[model samples]
Target: MSDLSGSERRKLEKLLGMGSGYVLNFSDRTFGDFFDEYRVEIDNEQYKTGGTSKANRMRTFWTVANNHVLGRVIEGLIEYANEEQCFGDSNPSLVTNCQNIAKRLLSDQPVAELDALTAISDDYDFEIVANHVREAIDKNQPEAALDRLHTFVNKLVRITCERYNIEITVDKPLNSVFGEYVKKLREDGHLESAMTDRILRTSISVLEAFNDVRNNKSLAHDNPILNYEESLLIFNHVAASIRFIKKLEASIKTKSATALDKTKDTKNDDFIPF
Candidate 1:
């Protein structure tokens, strides 16, 4: 029997302690092979340690510690697998560490970048996006506001789909979700018919674009950059589609003004109908 590696022994101890009354067994040579790689990183002897944390000294030690711990977590999982170590002892704990990393990664936040977060708060939270929409509405720029809203909704849908690795070319499902969001705004009085035409037009465009993508057809016949690009075709389209909100508001204001004018004219004509 050869000697056991440090991480291998660490994993064994963890499994034995966690499994407690349960049966536990693993070969030492296999365990050593499992941890051979990460154990090197634990010592920082491989000359590769951290990514974002090491690059920027501003990152807190806690963040650095979290990432450094991941090296062991990786080693632990490897050892667990090699030893056929049942009981789910090491994995569940190590997975928690991986889950934490995944959660933070999704934030699109870098510990070194403070100013970057202000612009990208929306990338993480829709509530932040909603607050921005509220400000645009308060500014009486509902058209500009809806355009922003459309962009937000479209991106939300696309991201959700892409994260699942579904076909991005087939966007109707995503559009369908945003359509519901738009209808919600309409029901809440955030949108009206003057806007409906434009919304419908955009919806049709999205549907059309989706068809084009699915059928290998296109109006422009060439892909655009961002919203106008070869990629992000739908994202860019949704962003551009909100321009009709202005016309919706304008049409309403015009109709109301005309109605008021007609009433004043009748009063001046002495049309009391007596």
Candidate 2:
């Protein structure tokens, strides 16, 4: 269940046009489609009964959804309202109020880091694994996501290696692939700070141990899972490393593009008429 206070919930209900029997500017079909985009089944019998209004359905959703899903749904509604011009001169503060509520609801979620992983790649396999991790995290069950997170990291590292022309085999474990990527970054002069380099080296061992956790202590097998706090800690650690790599790769692309532009300019200069 979400942690929204009663006043906050009422504010959201009013801003979303749910104070009446409606929700935002969505029709019945469009409402279902909107929820479906986030994998939320709002039409389930559990959320619907005899003459249950759309407002009530949304209220039910808020009552049962975890913070992560609740935050996403709220943000979706805000975006939809903006697109539909639901907030006209009649209610000038509607958008700001909605945004403030969303910020409070999502304040402690690790949504940005999770989003960063998918931003790094659009591979079908990567998205599938990323979604599983997201579902687990949304349901507040990080332990169940451990195996999927490992697979996601492996895919990310392999993609990074391929992008940089670093040799990697499928059989190589996550730590090995990641270690090689780190070594390449250092060799290519991308590792500018001693502290950053040390962190990457530490992540190598962390991912090495993660293999064992995925195999033995995770949902990958019939063994007891790690406790929630430690699982969350591991998730945060791995996510931070992924965010760092994402920035590093982005910087490399920018530099390569700049160099290519310079080369083109040089060629253009040489082609000028005498």
Best by lDDT: 2
Cα lDDT of model 2 by residue, 45-111, tens digit: 7777534778888888888776766887888888887788886663657667767777777765754
User: How well does model 1 score by local distance difference test?
Assistant: 0.42
Clash pairs for candidate 2: none
Worst 10 residues of 1 by lDDT: 53-62
Report, for every candidate in turn, its global Cα lDDT versus the true structure. Answer: 0.42, 0.81
**Which candidate leads the pack in TM-score?**
2
- TM-score against truth, every candidate: 0.23, 0.64
**Over all chains combined, what TM-score does candidate 1 have?**
0.23
Q: Which stretches of candidate 2 lie over 4 Å from their true place?
A: 1-103, 110-112, 272-274
Error of 1 at 227 (Å): 11
